[model samples]
Target chain A: MMRLDNTEIRIGFFGALAVAALATLPLFSQGYYLSLGVNLMLYAALCTAWSLFSGPTHYISLATAAFFGLGTYTVGLWVDHVSFPLLVLGGGLVAAGLAALVGLATLRLSGVYFVIFTLGLAELVRQIVSWTQTKVSTRMGLYVFTDFTEVHIYWMLLALTVAVFVTGWLIGRSRLGFAMKIIGNDETVARHVGIDTARAKILLFMISGAFIGIAGAISAPRYAYIEPPSAFNPMISFLVVIMALLGGTKRLWGPLVGVIPFTILFDQVSAQFPNHTPIVMGLAFLAIVYLLPDGVTGRLEQLRARMKRPREKLGEEVRA
Target chain B: MQIIVTGILLGGTYALIALGLTLQYGVARIMNLANGETFVAACFIAFWLFTAMQINPLVGLVIIAPAAFAINWAIYSVLLKPLVDRAKNRGMLEVDSILATFGLLFLLQGLMLLAFGGSYFSYTFLAERFMILGNPFGLNRVVAFVAAVVIAVALYWFLYRTRHGTAVRAVAVDPNSAKLVAIDVAKTAAFAFALGGALTACGGALLSTFYTFNASMGVVFTMKALIIVIMGGVGDVRGAVLAALILGITETAVASLIDPGLTIAATYALFIIVLLFRPQGMFGRQTT
Candidate 1:
């Protein structure tokens, strides 16, 4: 077991405190805020789950929506026959299985090819689901009827977000995380150093898919009705990528930092100027990519290091 | 026979679009994710010109091509060049370019959405139909096919027979070696981007004459072009043409033979299979 650093301990403490505070929020808030909290938690979990693989390996998988959609469909098909928790776990396993198959086939390919393959994977899954629905069912969507309240859904999402966050933190402090970082830096060198780069990548890919799948399973019932388009929305994939990048994927808290402000901005902009929301969001993304390529957390780290330099020099001068 | 003819005709436009992508990605090593958006923007330009003025889309192509070339040149010089330079300095050019171009995709799409709302538009330029082998073919489709072939041939000639084309190829092969021969690497890159923009714009203009399209259509077109380019082996023009034909035929066959809803899925499956078996592409040099 790896020992925790001082910063890690403090972060853990504050993180637990934040989760406790958020868990109690539904008690004081009304329906609208509770729903908003649910959306926030959903996206937070997604972004964190995305960073689990793409952040470290820099592969830029565009198949998150594919796995998420698979999980939703898994629950949609079997929600009536199985227990809720069992269905959720089944959803995660299904996504993980698909990810493993895809990762095994495509992980050896580099650069744009890999990105395009992932994009195609999502589109392929969407098409298959749509086709199957048309051929097999009278309706294209499933109506989910449950007695779960708004607060109950909110708690579920919150639990998912916490689970994703802890997984991210643990991975960051693990030996696997070190290997992934090395691979991200340079795959060729990592392989030369005896890293099973492909195996590592495929493993991370499956892990990431499982978490996103669980998030999708937990969030699926909230929709009341789920269809191919809603379940496999490519926009969700893009948003997760943008949020994770904006927060600086190199750190554990990057996705959390990114999802909060961006989700609020998304809600506000869409509510006020629905037609122009894309333009607003697009411009914001452009600005972030150009000016803050390292993301908010990465930039803060730079600033902190810069500030520390003068203090270190002063200490050395006094010693001299 | 009808399906084959139709697929080949449609492949003409796909080839043109893939050619543009090959130039940007294969030759210049810049992954222009907004490639399809450029095509859509040109389509919109033609549509607006036709609707506002009595200008024919064919006539508007003259305006669209040059305008697109200039716009893309400016994008490369201003937005992408700095990022490329920095990535090169840091040795992360491939990944950085992908993200930067992805940003450009969103930027272009958003701007287009703001300018032209989510509505479908088509150029109703030649509404006549002619029968060939007992199959009714649109005059617009025939014209678009002819135009696509002519432009593709011209592009091939330029790349092979012209001095500037040779310089572009030289840079694509080895930038250091090209620079040693006094070839302006940066200028060639810019020119390639401009040419790519022009080709895709021309494709869009031709397609507008036949197909109804909206802003969101850019993403689909981009994916199709990417598939063709990957299949042809990045940067291989001849390979792109062949791959585009194959894809077009496959799509048309699937739509007619099996189910229309399965066309896109079929293409995606082909892409995955290709990546697994031959990631270097059909025409590319062996790398992986």
Candidate 2:
């Protein structure tokens, strides 16, 4: 137990050090590299936030785009009127509120129904936003001008990523996390065991929504302009799901493992063959599903177990 | 009255679209997200046939349907067979197939975009209007509607009157018991998936006769089809047809009465209400 605790502490220490090191990238790197760092941190935060709820519950929510867009639009609508930090906070709150309402109505649905409902929710929100914007203003897009540089956005995203990781870790150790694991394994059994599955799911989903919203809010200024199509793009949801799955959602840090490589690869592909980006993404998704069902971290764990098993068997033979 | 007539006519083709999705999800146990891409691919082919060879979209269906069937069969056999084989349970298969087909969606969409740039294509094939209840309606739409009805009727007859179709339905109901009764579950699933793909292609070809289409427009049809499938119940043919009309009418009403931009939002609103009130779908019996 002591050794396990010591290992946990060591991991926490090293994780902080690594993030701190990443925070210094803007000092040495400029232009494309700095922007790439920002992109990496943005996705890392989004994927981590997504996995916080979806990882444990086994309920895949594609509503990340909805919440993210709400965050983005919140910033867009109020960039001039509201302070930047206030807008970020308001964006997260708005997203969480929407999540609570949506969760109440749709969390009862299981399996594919839940998945489809969330997917529809994003599209619905986008349409409504588009319609309202059309009615309210002649211009469909809002331009956002802020004094914040790429460095500031990168730092904000990095901080958000760390916060999401820490929160996820804390949740994983809490009773709520224990309940969520039970729900994930078997919701009916969890319900039979007197767990309030709905409440648990809603709470986690709200937290996930809030984090996604904050990430969007932080990244909004970087775009300089926000339109309904780009802000509420479903590709964001797809990428987050693919990344989280690729990392293996079993561990808090798993999504980070997937996000880093995927973001980098996506950047390179889009830069080189912009028209074929979707094709590459599609292929990547198929490869990941077939070859790494358990994800990179999960595959690594299996390899470690296999390696240890042979050594343990040899030791038993020596004893015999 | 005008809205009702137009809605019903539009719904006829929508029913055909939804029917394909129902079969794919019901019998094959694969919720194919690429279903719309098949429709779009057919639309493109139909366009090509019309513009290049002066072939009618109706005649083009003869070529497109069979090719779609062959492609879907190959996809099921090569890509989805391994997934179905390895899946530990229904839920695992659902997740795996959804992810796989989601990838397939992007793949097909990307290919279509590459072949046909991001421009809307609508040929002047029977654009003449005819009177229907004192309202003018496109002749192409009426032809497409009639073709959809014929295909849907033929599908119905096959499912109800044939021995092979009985086995397919049995697999949809319960794959394990169907296997016990000597039905080849895998074979039936492959057939249903291919049939579904063919049906979707047919719908696409017919729609291409009248509807303006682009590569990315496939996802909209997909979402509309998905909404119909769920609202009608996963495997229920009659329910899908009914739900399609409901959707078509509602959308037309919303577009005519309210803002045109709110049509998608209205579809979602209805979907959410149905999901909240009756998760089993309109015609589906409650399962424990």
Q: What TM-score would every model get versus the actual structure? A: 0.96, 0.97
Writing each residue's lDDT as its tens digit, candidate 2 over B105-223 gives: 88888888888888999898899988987889999989889999999999999998999989989998999999999999999999999999999999999988888899988778888
Candidate 2 chain A has its poorest 10 consecutive residues by lDDT at A1-10
DockQ of each: 0.63, 0.73
**DockQ value of candidate 2:** 0.73
Q: What is the C-alpha lDDT profile of model 1 across A226-262, one tens digit per residue? A: 9888899887787888888889888877878888999
- Predicted structure with the largest TM-score when compared to the true one: 2
lDDT of 1 by residue, B1-288 (tens): 888888988899899899999999877788777899999998888888888997888899899999999998999999888877877432367667777777778778888887877898876889899787889999888898898999999998998999998998898788889999999999999999889999999999889988898987787888999999988987888999999988988899899998998988878877877877777889677753
* Residue B8 in model 1: lDDT: 88
The best candidate in terms of lDDT: 2
Report the error of model 2 at residue A68, Å: 1.0
Candidate 1: misplaced stretches above 4 Å? A1-10, A315-320, B89-91
Q: Looking at model 1 chain A, which ten-residue stretch has the lowest summed lDDT?
A: A276-285
Residue A84 of model 2 has an lDDT of 95
